[model samples]
Target: MFDINGGELIVLFVVAALVIGPQRLPAYAEQLAVLVRRGREWISQARTRLDEETGDLGVDWEALDPRKYDPRRIVRDALLDEPSTARRAAASAVVGIPPAASAPLVGPAPYDDEAT
Candidate 1:
């Protein structure tokens, strides 16, 4: 993300070594690693908590994905309804049954011998 290259990294190491001295550089590096790790953990925890809180609200996370926001994808999805949903609606119309009432068509067995 930082776009740092190998040359830049070597320069940074040399400068750090000169400024911090070889004596304490390893210790400082370890501390930096620990700080970075902790920051990652904190960020992960925050994301998990946010997801959990939103889970109950029936949010469609895929709809919120940045990649799906492309204008082409948006237009495509808008112009073409999901094929399965369209078929289900058509079946309901032909059968004179509401979509909910036809849930058994898509779901597991609705009538069990034990229930009968």
Candidate 2:
């Protein structure tokens, strides 16, 4: 999730190398590798356990996926929708709810240059 670039990564590596001496760096690296391996194993186990627990819930996995909760896509779909029927539009006006429409025109525009 970090937005680290190559130059920044090199700087980080140089700083880490300077802080942690070369003599002990190998040992620390080995420990870090082990920690990462264990963390991955723990995550995999947790995921499997979760799947086993919820495997029979009849869940629509794709529908429930977090990635599908996109506000832009929802708004695009809403905006692209055609206008409602004439009866429904009338009902929406009566209910004070704006109708979902594509460039709906109310009536002829009032114009008078001398009114101002």
Candidate 3:
């Protein structure tokens, strides 16, 4: 994220080595590793808690993958929940669409210059 390249990394290592000294570098590295491990454990615990809460609500926690945590995916899934007429009517109401229309009115579209 910081965009540190190989040269910058080498410089950072040199600076760290100098400031921390050779003897204390290993100790500091070990402490840093421990902190990273603890942070990961905390994240895992939080995820587990979230999973439990979702499961209690009858949600499939396994279906909720972190990599697929896109707002578009959530919206699409909500929209495609049911193919039945009654469910579609309910969905249309939720989305502020009139049940008589096949598509929702979203205001006038811009004229396509290339179409002519």
For each candidate, give its TM-score against the true structure: 0.49, 0.50, 0.47
- Residue runs of model 2 more than 4 Å from their true location after superposition: 1-3, 63-116
Pull out the clashing pairs in model 3.
Answer: none
- Please state the error at residue 106 of candidate 1 in Å: 30
Q: What is the C-alpha lDDT of each candidate?
A: 0.84, 0.84, 0.84
lDDT of 2 at 66: 92
Residue-level lDDT of model 2, residues 32-114, one tens digit each, is 99999999999999999998987888778898789889989888786666656886778788878777742345555678989
- lDDT tens string, model 1, 1-116? 99999999999989989999989999999999999999999999999999888777877879998876799877767556445777878899999998887653343436777974
* Stretches of model 1 off by over 4 angstroms after superposition: 1-3, 56-116
lDDT of 3 by residue, 27-78 (tens): 9999999999999999999999998887777776667978768899788786
**What range of 10 consecutive residues in model 3 has the weakest lDDT sum?**
101-110
Candidate 2: C-alpha lDDT: 0.84
